[model samples]
Target: MSEFNTTAFQPSLFILTGLRRLAGSRLWLGLLLSLMYIITMVGNCTVIHLVRKERSLQEPQYLFLSMLAWADIVLSVSTLLSVLKVYILGLYEIAFDSCLTQMFFIHTSSSVGSGILLAMAFNHFVAISKPLQYTTILTSSRVTRMGLAALLRAVALMTPLPILLKRLPFCKGRTLSYSYCLHPNVMKLACGQVRINILYGLVLVLFSFGVDSLLIAISYVLIFQAVLGIASREGQMKALNTCLSHIFTVFIYYGPLLAITVMHRISIRSSPVAHAVLGNVYLFMPPMLNPIVYSLKTKQIRTALRKSCKIQRS
Candidate 1:
């Protein structure tokens, strides 16, 4: 271990890289990112507001939607400043501790988002399969408990990441592949034995995203079985329509995620721009699109939005 101690060095700061190829077009890129950030914040905040203010939206699904909006807001804020700093202000260096903090929040919020999606699937399942027990099973207190549980679980799972990263010696260049810090990207910079880190990350993925996806799929299958048992075609159509917004949001959230995962593990030699763009999309798109999807697909939200707008105008 004497040899290890001699070479061990902790970086003071990490460099964040945006689209290197489009360095000259930073103004446009920054503007776009800024716009996306604004939309994400506004959209999610509106969802939260609508859920809280509108008495009609106090149901389990809308409450769960509000929880998801909160997650999206957290996720977007975690990345917003760092990304803007790099692209807009040309300030790419981030302090080591700050990077770790960002990574923690980002991962925690992401896990929470995934968990919320799972909870939503369960919500849909209960609403469809056991309509009578839905209110009894998912009372206000229980929904609140579920939300807190998701937050706590995410924190518990992601807490180890920053600690593990802090212990390792980072001798590689301080340049991060993306504007924000991620466990795998940070781990790649460590010169010390990181087998434990890699294994832990894989464990996180398997237990969180992997397990959540499986459960969500099972929930949908059960939902389908319930739908099929409905005697009338109109009832079946109405039931399926309730899931359209959620299904779209799920696909939007997971598509870039799957691509990013593939690029991280398999196509390691792809362009840095590809990695950066996909990272941005994974972080940005779901948050921006979720509220829109729900608002468009769910008539209630649209009506509430219009009512809110007219009230403001008056």
Candidate 2:
């Protein structure tokens, strides 16, 4: 089959196929997705609010935490709107330009979120691995600059992606199989040679996602080594506890991401519903879980939440 004619070329087919297995039930999928989105919004907002309201939490670390929460909020809103359009409105067809726009923002948000996580990892490393330098290294001004730089890097790196996609001639099926415009899904529709596009997409995966993940792993390794060097048992325990929130958040973000990447690579004839569901999970699940994980795992956040609730009650 031509690249455009592959089974994966059909956008909604994967989604419909998966939904059919649920006894042809769109209502159930819609309901479940809606509930998930609501939870995601509430959880992310709570985190942002707690960080802002608590005076003690006003450190450089929590500031980054707030930015991460805001990114999740944006991602959740975008995903929810698109999913609702697909499930409720039955709108499956997307224009070429619209697809490019959606793909750009989705990719941008995903990349930016990953970058922010890396920043968080670095912050923890400084705090745990280099205690004396922590104040100088993570000053408010420096954190602000770093946060802006990460966002700018995401925009610069991903901006070319959509433009390159738009230049391709999509001679095959214009109808996207998935609800949103993902790079692979859209690339499948290109009538022209897509070798370059494929290579570029792979490069993006490697550099943006793969490289960042490796760096995070290395940072944690160093952190662990430093923690081990501490003479006091209580000090080691405290350092480990400090790293817990970032570790949990990284797992939540990277786990579904790796799953979706694998599915996209190996599942040649996967159903549209399967792709859609997985894509949604990869994009939104981390954001959804982040607030809950940090709130429950971090002592500071838990205390802030309790205090926020008490103040609200008054």
The C-alpha RMSD in Å for every predicted model, in order, reads 1.3, 4.0
Candidate 2 local lDDT, 81-109, one digit each (tens): 56776666665455555667777878888
On the 0 to 100 scale, the lDDT of residue 72 in model 2 is 85
Off by over 4 Å in 1: 6-8
> Who wins the TM-score comparison?
1
Which candidate has the top score in lDDT?
Answer: 1
Q: Model 1: C-alpha RMSD to truth?
A: 1.3
Q: What is the TM-score of each candidate against the true structure?
A: 0.97, 0.89
Worst window of 10 by summed lDDT in candidate 1: 1-10
| Candidate 1 lDDT, 131-151, residue by residue in tens | 999999999999999999999
What would the TM-score be for candidate 1 when compared with the true structure?
Answer: 0.97
